[model samples]
Target: MEAKVILIIVTTGLIWLIQLSSVEATQWHSKQLLPYFRRIKLDKTKNSVYQHTVKDAIRMHLRIPLMQKALCLPKGTKVSKHLQYADVSFALIILKSHCFHCVLQLSSDCLNRMVDKARQHENKFYARFTYACKTHAEYSSDCMESGRPMYYRNLRNLVKQTEKCWKL
Candidate 1:
């Protein structure tokens, strides 16, 4: 009889402990960003919409940040590699791939020329030449691929995403 009573008390205590744990779990909510990209820019400028746009682009792509052993990385990362020696990153590419969604506030034609010039200076920098319909038709079949941007059918959708994301 005593053994039975002890068992019952232990079971009751276990159940109560489980309930307490669940209650504690509910209070432990936290923000979730994948791969944990910590922003590295040291700039303190708060008035630039361009900076906000870049942040919005990162959010849209949902890119996993550079975790440990994230990606060995190629010598050339992207067109922006020419502009900046630092690798542009997969997160940045997936985020910034859209012409209309470009956070840099640069036109397709202008940016393309800038990329090409940069390539002239350093072959290591020229990574990719994205096909924008408004430009790059003369040298690329991709411009004629589907009456859309070379990467995705997403010209309109990209523009829409950019427009909607502008407020963020």
Candidate 2:
């Protein structure tokens, strides 16, 4: 009876090892048949191009020189048409910026370009803007009084909360 129990234990161990090896072999064979090229082709040929197209559609009418300069880095030529378009974009941004925090947080250079464009117009909408960290404790007194522009801490959920507030 002792010998029989030992044999059963040994058999079970061998069966587990064999199953593990089979799984490894199947993975190797499947990987060999597919190759990495198939996965890369899908990302570059599909998703990347799709993202580029969407970006193109959104920037259609904006004639931004700084944006054109950034885009033309590899192209080695100057684009002239965007200068006029940038001005138009600036006016629209200032009008909408009265209530959008994302617009306020854009880089200094982008804001400069937008302001330059805005200078050409009468700034009728009065773009009230402010900054915030993630914590809600840093509210600006002006923002609270007007119930307009507000600040926040740089917390991860800030964008979500901002979107929620703006939606209302």
Best by lDDT: 2
Q: What lDDT does model 2 reach?
A: 0.31
Local accuracy by lDDT, each model: 0.30, 0.31
Model 1, residue 108: distance off in Å is 38
For model 2, give the 10-residue run with minimal summed lDDT: 120-129
TM-score of 1: 0.21
User: What TM-score against the true fold does each predicted structure earn?
Assistant: 0.21, 0.23
In lDDT terms, how accurate is model 1?
Answer: 0.30
User: Model 2, 1-168: lDDT tens per residue?
Assistant: 999999999998987666545433323322332221122121233234333432332233222222322222212234443234333334332323222221112233433433333222211111221233223323344423332222111111222332233211
Would you list the clashing residue pairs of candidate 1? none
